[model samples]
Target: MNVNHSNITITESACKIADEICLPDTYLPRVVVIGGGFAGLALVEKLKHKEVQVVLIDKNNFHQFQPLFYQVATSALEPDSIVFPFRKQINGYKNVLFRLAEVEEIQPSTNTIITNKGNVHFDYLVLATGTTTNFFGMDSVESHSLGMKDIRDSLNIRHMMLQNLEQAAITCDDKERDALTNFVIVGGGPAGVEMAGALAEFCKYILPKDYPEYPSSIMNIYLIEAVGELLGAMSDKASSKTLKYLKDLKVKVLFNESVSDYDGSLVTTKSGKTILAKNLIWTAGVKGQFPKGIDEKHVVRGNRLKTNFFLMVEGYKNIFAIGDIAALISKDTPKGHPQVAQAAIQQGKWLGNSLLKIIKDKPVKPFEYKDKGSLATVGKRKAVADLGKFKFAGYFAWLLWSIVHLLSISGFRNRLMVGFNWAVSYFTYEKSNRLIIRNFKPKSLVNETEE
Candidate 1:
């Protein structure tokens, strides 16, 4: 028989069904949220005291603060500062249960989710699975290049970065060392820009001290973008200023060019130019990630799950899609809302309220996204922002960026730790921690990209 809340007696089979069988029966309608990302966490927070029985499941048990992932990669912040334990996050919620399991498929017809651990039935199913790195079928680039989508991805880049330098320091061969020192970054979104800037700062301040044997000139940083501009989603002010800031930092900005291919060593662009680098970071694009079973009709651009105005998956009564995974296509939002933390947080809270109305038999309101604005920080004391009408960059924007990011970080201790790290770096022109805690070996992009 299939496993479910109805079967209170624990199973002794190999799949460890006992892990879930112990959950106290609340006798309330079960709501299964697949993902512990911003949206899923927000939803669970709202459903905490509500009548619903919330089952929050994710491959990882923590709620990772994604916006700061680049910081983690650059070693400006550690992993623990960004990853909050799901159990601790929902400490007091007696109605909610947390599970760490990889979902294999969603059998909507039977109202069941099949995971590696077991099968779970749900009265309402929420897919806040978020997005995965998109290579757009570039076999070579996907295989050779690095992507930073989560904590694991960030740590991979971090370890590889220091490891490459360490390897270069010991290697006698010139070509190999040059390849190690050369850094090529694809995509000029917040991730790429921030990474490029952080790398530039490292090259300027940290690398010189860390590796005095290698000349600062030997280390080169390149920020390549396909479009003629960077920060394509923001205003002209941000785009123009950031480009100038990057140029000031000595980061080679390649505009109107896209990486055509990479063969583990050489990076060739569409313009026929080539760069030799061992470290190739691809922050180019991302597509929605979800388990199998959803039909193509409900899938749209960027491989996102299509939902109605109310955030419900089209043609499914109890299934809802939200956050980066959800593409709420409308005349106003042709391509769907920008896949940012704001969109996810808003949609999650909105859906949570809507669900309360659902259980209370009240009117369900449609979701409408409010674009707060966008912010991207470049080198030290350099940043840009675009509010609805006001567009600003430089010192004040930089200050705002620091404050906003610190506040937005998950925990008080995290914010304090990050702040302390920043202060030390600024005052000393040095970073205290830069360790290859884990030896990073690149994973199979084919298997890793999808999850």
Candidate 2:
């Protein structure tokens, strides 16, 4: 039966399964991707207009630029400037579709996925669900701290910092004021480093102007890391330079420290050290997130799905994994590829280009990751970059960082807005409007309210 898959429409080819998601019936292969992050989006872009129907499912309708999330957290950039709607991204792609749904489970035997809204059947399935903050069973810290994994977390940090600052001005108790103004950011990775840098900049440039009643030094910023050095993945030169940069900004860097607990106003470290900080941001760790149903044998450390060189999940024919949720463990990649955007994007592009060949039983090359170096910035005009054998730090590195991130943004409008904001801030040292749109409460308080 030779059917024209390209001309299929919703009305002409309605899904007949009871309670199943309504999708166009096409004879062409249907690739269901369970995420809209860098990996999934890159795959979708590669598959657009191809002889396949690509259904992208994500909890949010927009794709968040995660690298700049700290900027949003510290009011350096607005949320809208870093997020682009999926619909807008797939506007002209005729063969692509976007669905807003949270996947609950994956029934591999039936080749179906169960979502909160409905069920979706797939010819091929790709898990790019990414990772969530790993609290390591620390209930108190998880409840009291904010994790920098998404846009909402950024907004929460912003509101928490702003609200706490405002409260500091209103309170008369010295200890309470100190706690409210102090910030403790856990982790020495890129997210934590960038966040600490941005917050330090805010204290340096914006604090005195906005809250003249108090000295600029009133707001203390502390960055805690479990390891001895910052940015362990980068070069030593980059790491040392970064440490110097943060020290120049007066950011208290505490190495060989790990958070033990947080009570929303106090952070206790494993070494019995305690810091009074109402604002706590966690960027320490992340674990893979995906719908349950895969075999435990195929799962590895970090709760990630184990895959072969071809990026196909073991013990499954048409099931694959990518991005942070995937652990393609091998001799070369002992811990799987680094859970960074570049690796995910490359995996997605590789899979997208090779999937059709895979389906047709044709020869395809094994996935190989290319290291494009690492870049991190600390406040304005200070950054670090390790490109191949060349490692550098300072203004040129910062400029390179800005250009790379600006060009990497999804939409032109977003890029323009961010670029314009950066230009204005470069000369004037100003950030966007730090408006508190909604009241943000800690998880403990929210749970208490529910109770």
Candidate 3:
């Protein structure tokens, strides 16, 4: 049978080889994909009709749209709108199976993964395990700060913000009430910037109407960044514009500032100034979510696995890594590609195609990333977009950002729901996910930075 070289090809010989494994009493070459994040999902999707036996696994059942995680934290969009089921994402793919399991360790030499459930033997291993919030080894900060990585983390912050307002309303002591009303967000990334803007909007426009019992003016939102500016990855124009928008919304923007310490209620800055706040959200740093058995020395800067240009983990042939977990040791990206969804998705797609070629005994091409730029939404009708040659900031940029993200979301339902929420929120200047369905208890909070 003749085969076209244009489309991705899995050779008839490779197909026959894969088919032999599906035969009874024979060991099949299993391709195990760990962490069902953007990278893992994209990889699995691309291998839908491939010959390999694929297994996709993650700690959580649903794949989170991490870019809009801050929106969930600030109650701009509900958790449902940003999360989609992993099984549903890979449904009807006979070659693929989904597993909800936390990986304990990766034994690359034996091509095995030891998870909480059991050990999985693999012919080809993909470590798309992603990353975890980094507290920079500060236990005090780690224990007290709120992170927005998952739905639970987002909902926890949501509860904390609402609970703080409720507590402030009833507190008779002036100092205690003041502490309850103050929110300190650490880091100047998109999450911190967006959260600060959202909190300010809530206090400025929404809080007074919702909590008439308390003075909305008393609520203070502080965005502290160690760097000199916000959105450090974006263009200077975008960064400056976002800073202006945030300040205009009444968010106290502290530049070149770092949180030296936090004792649950007070945030002490590097400059020796202390801010009293019951809520301290950490959007500071993230490290790779490496499994247990991997040698700690293999983890380089940002706790990422050192990989080659082809995204293969160092010292291993069949074992590969992508997304937040993989660190390409190249002159171009000496550290690694930015741990963004686009990088992960692209790498995943590339890996899927490369592996198919390898299985068919064809030369595998080295992966090269095509930069598509970056964008971040600050608040209602305010955003910044940096499209390499073309950079713009403001309402038009915000509209573009919304459209891009809405289309990029995994499921159709999520896109529709998020689109609807945005339209309604834009028209009324109101967010629908503001209801406090459950009271937040400080003791019930789980640290999102648990590694």
Candidate 4:
């Protein structure tokens, strides 16, 4: 298969570049993956010893640990702790090569994949581009809100948060100070809940120590969700426990309250109540970031491509979609599996084993999702957990969540550092490194877009 990277002059250069990069190739049975997120990282790591030539391409070079992204946003952890360099992570693997480029398209018809850098031929393709925050096509939310999907977004949060606090410190005006101190987090997902809790802690426990001039009592954190409860995926017990914990942490929980629109200064809820603030964090819906060439009809709910039992695209054999991008079109998971790291890791490992079996002409085992459990932390000594039959909440649950995350981190050094930070924070109730490294403006889209 031959591919060309060119498009009509009417399209922008980036769009054209993406178009050209989507072509297929005819050479070796190359395994090309898009996106360097959890799913792609899992795939590359699992396929490290495979005989096939594997090329993993992503716009960014690091794989982000999304679970702790909220901590980074709220100054609990550093960016390095949550993100590992992709090349460094896969350096020991001989077959994998990491490329830093945006995949513009996927032209599976020609078996060639086009990227910003050039074209790559693939025998098997995995679209693990993952998902992006979906503001439900709301233009105001899309343009004026902040997203915490990756490292860059976390840094932006850190920057904006610090800047806001500093600006609020100097102001004696009550309205301006209230607006600056007020934080409206859109979405009641784990990210939203976690962020709200962390920010609340900052205001109640941490920020009081840092900014002694301004009263922490004026600082307010609002967690708005269109749904009736938080942690919707978890059990009702977990949800109830989490709600109580958040309330205890002083997070203003807004249930069944949807955000109508957001300007840079104010967040207007669907209930018509307006929240005046400079920061609006969006952790709402997320849609799969699939590569082109697949039929739009195959794209199901959540923007995920419908995949067969073996994780192969419904109408294609050589192509596969995994993680958040793959929608298992089964009655059991009509909408698809939750876009979590565990699901992606399982899919990647299954694909690796399945590929080996396929080369020897063996039957491929169907992918089965094992739901280990779910956990979300509220502030200090407060968390909720759902483990199949067993449920835990409060301090014990928080401890469990901490231990699990520490073990799940990608690198040994990161694990150590994060553990140390957690210990320090647990003891002090203050994040060690709250220094502002960069000044970020919400309008700085090119610089602040999450990787």
Q: Every model's Cα RMSD, please?
A: 4.2, 1.7, 5.2, 6.4
Better model by TM-score: candidate 1 vs candidate 2: 2
> Against the hidden true structure, what lDDT does model 2 obtain?
0.93
Pull out the clashing pairs in model 3: none
- Which candidate should be chosen as best, given TM-score against the real structure? 2
lDDT of residue 2 for candidate 2: 29
lDDT of 3 by residue, 287-378 (tens): 88878777777779988998887888887788889999999978898878988989999999999888877666799879999889999888
Off by over 4 Å in 4: 1-28, 444-451
CA lDDT for candidate 3: 0.83
Residue by residue across 356-387, what tens digits does model 2's lDDT show?
78978899999999999999999999999999
Worst 10 residues of 2 by lDDT: 1-10
Q: Largest lDDT belongs to which candidate?
A: 2
Ranking 2 against 3 by lDDT, winner = 2
> lDDT by residue for model 4 over 272-381, one digit each (tens)?
89988878899988987765778887888878899899898888888888888889977898788888988998898888778767755789779999999998998889
Q: What is the lDDT of residue 226 in candidate 4?
A: 93
Question: Lowest lDDT 10-mer window, candidate 3?
Answer: 18-27
